[model samples]
Target: MGSGDGALNTPRWLRGIWVIPLAFLLVFLALPLVVLIIRTWSGDGWRILANASTWQITALATVQAVLSTVLSLAVGLPIAAVVSRYSFRGRALAQALVTVPFVMPTVVVALAFRSLLGSALPQGFLIVVLAHAYVNLAVVVRIVGSQWSQHDDRYARVAQTLGATPLTVFRTVTLPYLRSSIISSSVVVFIFSFTSLGIIVLLGDSSTRTLESQILRRTSVLLDFPAAAALAVLQLIVICIVIALGAVASRKRGQQKPVRNALLSMPTNRASRTAIHLIAVCSCAIVLLPVFALLIASVRSNSGLTTQWWTSINAIDSGTTRIGSPVASLAQSLQFALITGIVASLVGGCAALAVLAHRWGRFIALFAIIPLGISAATLGLGMLLAFGRPPVDLRASGLLIPLAHSLVAVPLVVAVIAPALRGIDPRAREVAATLGARPTRAFFTAYGPTLRTVMLAAGGLACAVSLGEFGAASFLARTGAPTVPIQIVRLLSRPGEQSYGVAAVMSLILIALTLVLVLVVDRLGRRNGALRPAH
Candidate 1:
């Protein structure tokens, strides 16, 4: 439509678009943080900061995070190069499957690792790093893969034609193109590992503890609110600084054109093809081994391999002291999932829309993502202090876990929706207005379809996130009303072959649930053409 047509159709409210998202950030993101800060400040918060153990944990967490990031990149970059840059028969499936580990609950991943490699490898730094790397593979693959897809292969070809060695061409051209994505994905992976709770708790020794774990210990184990708050502040500062650095690094790459889909090509040489196949097969095996182990354990028993675990899932707790029935955990987890999905989508969707509606949208959007920086344990602790008490005890109400999960998920929803909102053509609203649609109707006309698709996608993402979430759930979970992750932890804490086997079975179920949620979400996005190659 022409500019005049757009101007005539445009509504007055577009001028004040900032109000919605700002309000959202104020209530959901800003308020909780303020409460945390106040609680810390009210006590001797500064002394807590001076504690040597705090720095020790932070340093260790940083080291672990860095190592995890490196491993994820090393593993993910190759798979990304293959699936995004080259087409094979199962390329789409491969891409989707790689995201499985990321979406699975950290506890599930940790248990799977124990089942797979626990006997062979002790749980500590190495196992912790491996589990982290496995979980974060999707971040590297999706982010870097997006950039790799856009990489003009012809540039490498041109370098080769000019006598540049393959290694040199990659170093000079391909690496430079991927640098921003690398930095961004690295920061994200680092943050995840640094603030890790479930995996570290389940698979780590004292050396593997992060500030997140520390916060949980302070709040729940020690009942030291001030100390927990201080640790949370320190963690938030570190995360913000890292995120800022990533933003700067990404900006150095400047504006890049979105990549349209490119045709996939198979390797021409037998050696090159064999290498590609080897990498693909090995990557898949590495990713699936732990899950396979978990599956086997779920069905095995003392005599030998049996379907007893699966068969007795319904009756697993009939005559036992287990927290609840094994099957009951599934029902509890599903209920939480439903609540989390609805709440996060509404809150996060509003926050995203608020971003498009206001001048301060970027700030609000940034605030929404702050949960990514805060450890799940810290958030859980703060929520506990703020709401887990007698007068406002949400734990009894059965809303605390879902509420906490929603807090963690709001940022993801904003991430998914904001970029999509940016991609919508502003002129569409104008066109709708010119056709005599009301302002609100025009705005919906422009963004409604994409919003609908992304909201569901975001909701599914939130549900999947909540499904696998262990750390925060660990803090907020009541003794009698344990979620699956909580149940898994309880099972692991106990002694016996039966306990371990049952835990493994639960881990497998959790993994399957998470994978199903993610695949379904990916499928929806695909249907909406969101997963199609960008131009």
Candidate 2:
């Protein structure tokens, strides 16, 4: 690690180590794509894409995703407006609560929604759409809210002064300012909703079929690898098209920011202030209710509020007779999370460092992030083909999940560390040299503490991801070695109140663990000012 002019002067050993991340991406990422393409092109998979059901389901998923995106924007824009612009008491906590849903495992969120909306809303199109909106609220809030806080309000004031009504001012002035951010957030939410698997499985009916869910069905239930590969290809095409269109729309509108961020301001009138605070309060409630419901569900039973489920968590037969202890899934998830943490930190940290040191640094950084565009389900299936077989059996080695998760998480790790690394002061090393410190010691003086904090934070975030990850784990987890998310799904699929109670218990545990990891990441990231956005 180094800074400024010294950035390119990083140790040769560090530069050479960049190959580890590269080879990892190759073996896991590139090889998988090649294998998937071969399977798709060489088999009868291409003909499956021509089936009328394929396009029919794709059309249905597109409509569902569009509705989910619209609903998320409608809900999220209001929460973002209150949390980002109008500062008030508990503002930080409100923003933090908004993020909890996004980071929670999709499967866990599905169960929580079932707990919260039972009888009030049946599980189908409406509930699936609502659940998707709830889960994706953060994508809109964080992305658009960051941009919302930066734009100058003078434009709105001027429009109002010219006799525009409040709605007119917003439509004409504020909305234009956030066009790019809204488009960006919309694209992400749409893609997520379109590719949803866990939520769709738990909360959706035939009307809400997504290609992701279809791929899983074709693969496991039908034992139709060719059909699954065909679905994968179709899914990739749709995602690429959406991304391409989002890019075009964003490029056309562009982004317009104030020369400098405006100062944080609060509404002056009692009515305006009351409205903002009320909205903030409601937003927090919306975020927390499902979680609370999940908690209650864990304790509630036919006899009225019993502790039977919590007590049975450690029993050898907590799940279906074949699956062994439910506690075992937690242990498996933790073990995998730790492995993912270590692998992702090393690989992602190296990729970030390479950006400051190698001539092809930007390429390595770009290569690492490519996994973000690929679906976890797709990558898991690819890994299954590439490494779950005769030539190599990562499934047998129990490294497949960690390796896939590391690829999934490395981009986020790079995002966290690169800026912090670049922000370091190079002159610190020179000062250390003047103090007679050795070159290695001098480099550490410049970058050691910051790198240490960021890497730790990044690793924690990776661990949180592995803990809640469902799409990949659902596909790759051995029948008997289910991860927490997979186990939760299995529990929810069976027919009984005890099953629901036990599932809720496991979901709550996963949420607690994830929240703890996020808290640690936040604490570490704050040391370098990367966690919180400036007002």
Candidate 3:
């Protein structure tokens, strides 16, 4: 087929499939952004941009985000080198444990850091940076590991065989191969750290205020929605610039040639093998120490490791303080997760499939990823402005959080499902069509089974995302029916050992749910025989 044969080359059944996802992004994604712009304009919120403090915070956040990204890469690169390159014992578990912090709620991670560090590390710049680095460890490991696993170490061997030293070989040969993934992951870590809200709120002093926290303060505390909108715009601008720079840097990495062999066998030498296992152990400790600290904190008290909090889990109610009970908040979170799973899978799945259907698919796909560059604070404040009231109010309807979450999760869903969809053989559909099957039937014959399997997997991921989302939930949740993260934050804000105990317990529960979902998604990806590399 020639380049001119474009959308017409697509199967009839697949054509025009972009409509559903387009409508979704327009109504939910684009609308909210438009609302933000209008709200900022009408309220003269743009004037807040003139505040010198805003720029100071922006400068401060950039520095903090840079340090966080550096630390994450420092910690994650070694673990990625060990886990992804070596075929050693506990390799699978090491990889799984590395991802735990990434999936856990931001607020929950904040609590774990606070509990783990306690009074030893003050709640300010260092603590906040550490928390950001911890949460972003997976971003570095997964992104860089994906490329590192496929990297041809033979290049290094060749260089080493020459006059080059080990460090020189790494700098000359290996680093170039890993540069793209490193830049990509660095951008992600930097954005998360810069736009961070939960960790900054819980573990930060005035020294660590981000535009995200500033927006939250302006909205909920100062009752200045206009000023919040201004901050949101500023945050979005910074994120867009970073994302653009990352894209350019990634593109600038020299052409990546395919390698015949990617994965390496377990090393034979004693020191080398020991080093791999040691790094794996150290990585696991880095990921799990905070979690273990939270666990111990949950049961311990001034009375020396009591179980009163565990026993009182059923009776603990934050409803009197305008939040729901622990059980009720969990239920609320579950419900939101379910809805988010259903909505995001459907919407994002359509977006993925659109790629096979029309040339317009690229635009739709890029549009869907827009949420990635927008901070959660912006998303939440935009939701509030757009649908919290008015001619169209979904505030008390219990659908707002799910809708917002669906928008957030759709990008992930597309990331998971699109590659698998693209991996399917078009010849299967053509074979079915040759057998006199209709267009829809033929399309189904090729894609239906894979779609079903991966949809469930993608849905599980969306559910996991909804389970732990905090920043947006904080803005949109009603006082009476707070989600799990919201309730946890509320509990921690109050005084006493009881509050601390309950919050820790909830954090562990949130951890369990997210990990279970991720585990299931991993299994489904394997079973579907998708593009993901098998262990």
Candidate 3: tens digits of C-alpha lDDT, residues 145-248 = 98888887778888988989978987988888888889999999999999998888888899999999999899899989988988898788888889899998
lDDT of 1 by residue, 1-101 (tens): 11233444434564444455456456545666787899888888769778788788888889999999999999999988887888777777677778778
How close is every model to the real structure, measured as TM-score?
0.91, 0.95, 0.96
Candidate 2 on 1-535: residue-level lDDT in tens? 4324555445557657668779988988999888988998888888887799999999999999999999999999999988887657799999999999998999989999999897798889999999999999999999999888787887888888999999999898888888888999999999999999999999999999999998888878997877887788789889999999999888855445563556356767889878888899999999999999999999999889999999988883656557867899899999999999999989988898788767677788899988877787888888888887788888978899888888888988888887788888778877887798776787778889988988888899999989988887777888878898998998888898988999999999999999999889988777778543111
| Clashing pairs for predicted structure model 2, backbone only | none
Worst 10 residues of 1 by lDDT: 1-10
Error of 3 at 533 (Å): 11
The residue-level lDDT of candidate 2 at 309 comes to 94
**Candidate 3, superposed: residue stretches over 4 Å from native:** 1-14, 318-321, 531-535
Where in model 1 is the C-alpha error above 4 Å? Answer: 1-24, 253-259, 318-322, 425-432, 441-446, 531-535
Error of 3 at 426 (Å): 0.7
Clashing pairs in 3: none
Question: Which candidate's lDDT is highest?
Answer: 3
